[model samples]
Target: MRLPVRIALLLILFFCADLCFSYVQKELRPQTALQERDIPNALHPLVKQNAELLQTAALKKGITVVITEGFRSIEEQNELYRQGRSKKGNIVTYAKGGESYHNYGLAIDFALQKKDGSLIWDMTYDGNQNGRPDWLEVVSIAKTLGFDWGGDWRNFKDYPHLQMIPG
Candidate 1:
């Protein structure tokens, strides 16, 4: 093949390879639909069902509540508890293993998002005056579905936390 012809073919082949790679990446990429893993470890079986119901209800309300964390093993619970107690940061979780409602599957952590995958999670309650407006927008929606808002806790207030009372 002539030098120019060979180079032209190479460029075309390179472009085709790139195109195929892009396509494959798009197809192989994990389906990040809802964060199923966000469900906390402490949820009770009935609470889990309540959470599922709330998830669907939130979708109908126009906010996408994604489960970002879920079920915890005793080991995971212990580690988390330890981290909270000894860590340099402020104390967080009070429940350890059997103490945590997570052991019973009664709690869940959820986030809101637009269609483009922009997460709406707040580490603290009403993080700012304008902070986590996204999270607050739907907290009530979850309550409407019968879940208690951790934000209301007189002590250990967790704005992002929600729990359901088994009906």
Candidate 2:
């Protein structure tokens, strides 16, 4: 009887140890995503905050603006740089890989969305008919929120781009 009780106790202890080990493994395991297009965790917090504020204010003005690009990887930036010079399409960007502020999570590009959900990159578009261009309004709000508009740059006019200069 004593031997049987000892065996049962040993089995119970073994089972409890296995369960504890499994719990610890589950807790320490890294998490992964099911979707590839999900927003990356590396976006700077200030960029996210200002982008959200810009979106909210645009919505209130009946102007729908969507952030189309942010935080591009060096590889992605390189591909964009190749577009007009090496590749077939028009030159979309002047900055190569590491040179873009997008590579540092400080820049974002936006496009206007019409009520029917069509996206437009036209800077003079006034989909809400608010008398002012929607793109300019977005740039204005972005400036107030601490972003510098790429449209104001004298060399390359990138109307959709907004960047936060690090001080």
Candidate 3:
């Protein structure tokens, strides 16, 4: 093969490789950061306060709850909306970017944290030995704190979702 053609091919391969890496990184970032990051500063003050209270209340019941999402950016929401549609995961959300209360910092998604420190989404897991499911307990607390449970939605039940709307 000619030297110039070989050099051109190498450059093309490098460009393609870079593009692929960038795409993968972009796709993985939100999922990777889901429960790892702190609750976003963009959350409404009252919502943030209630979230903390909800956690404390759950902890008192021997259930550790972790906020998995808060104050999502439009781009992140779009990425999530792509799942099970344009992407390779189950459809986790029905709302698009601007449609979700998360876009405005009024919503959150939560999971139960086990004694082992790992998170689980199992709604029926009763790690606390409570006859009542811990997930429902948390939802009850969240509702008292003024959060609307997505699990109650008639159309789509997003069990992990909680949102506060001004009255």
Candidate 4:
């Protein structure tokens, strides 16, 4: 083969290899990590503002909260729905694909952030020592910010979920 042709072929192979590696790396990342990383950029404007307020209010009450998920894609929602039914994990959600508010960028899932920076979804954890669970405190603050807590749902209590419905 000509030298120029060989060089071009080598560059093409390198580009293809690089693309594949990038895709593999992304696919290997934990789903929660991806969602958390995308939260700030993926949420709707009003939802984001309210989430910020909720976080601030929770903090003032000596509770440290973290948004674990925001603006879920339909594909991600489907994957969640499949859990327990078709997947190995326990069922985490009833909503599938477009059915959830997260698909519309209006929903967020939160967790408690301990002082050591570890996250927990324990609803009974009262890290703030305020006689009330920090999770409930965050929920109260979220409600004040116009977010509806999924924990209020009768059918499925998703304690981590909150969403704002537009008027």
TM-score of each: 0.59, 0.73, 0.74, 0.73
lDDT of 4 at 98: 68
Stretches of candidate 1 off by over 4 Å are 1-43, 87-90, 122-133
- Model 2 misplaced stretches (Cα beyond 4 Å): 1-41
Q: Report the alpha-carbon TM-score of model 1 versus the true structure.
A: 0.59
The per-prediction tally of clashing pairs is 22, 0, 0, 0
Give the candidates in order of lDDT, highest first.
3, 4, 2, 1
Task: Give me the displacement of residue 86 in model 2, in angstroms.
Answer: 1.6
Q: Scored by CA lDDT, what does every candidate get?
A: 0.66, 0.82, 0.87, 0.83
* Tens-digit per-residue lDDT, 29-135, candidate 1: 32221123344445567767777877777666565777766566667777787874676656668767655545556667777666677776654434224445647
Candidate 3 Cα errors over 4 Å, as ranges = 1-41
The 10-residue segment of model 1 with minimum total lDDT is 28-37
Q: Write the per-residue lDDT of candidate 3 for residues 44-157, one digit (tens) a residue.
A: 788889999999999999999999998888788899999999999899888787777887788889999999999999988998997989999999999989998989987899
Task: Output the lDDT of residue 29, model 3.
Answer: 57
User: Could you give candidate 2's per-residue lDDT for residues 1-167 as a string of tens digits?
Assistant: 69999999999999999999998876443121111123343557789888999999989998888999988988899999999888999998998876777877778999999988999998888888879988888889899999988888878999899987444
> How do the residues 2-57 of candidate 4 rate in per-residue lDDT, one tens digit apiece?
99999999999999999999988865543333344333336788999999888888
Clashing pairs in 2: none
Clashes of 4: 0
Between prediction 1 and prediction 4, which has the larger lDDT? 4
Pairs with steric clashes in candidate 4:
none
Worst ten in a row by lDDT for model 3: 30-39
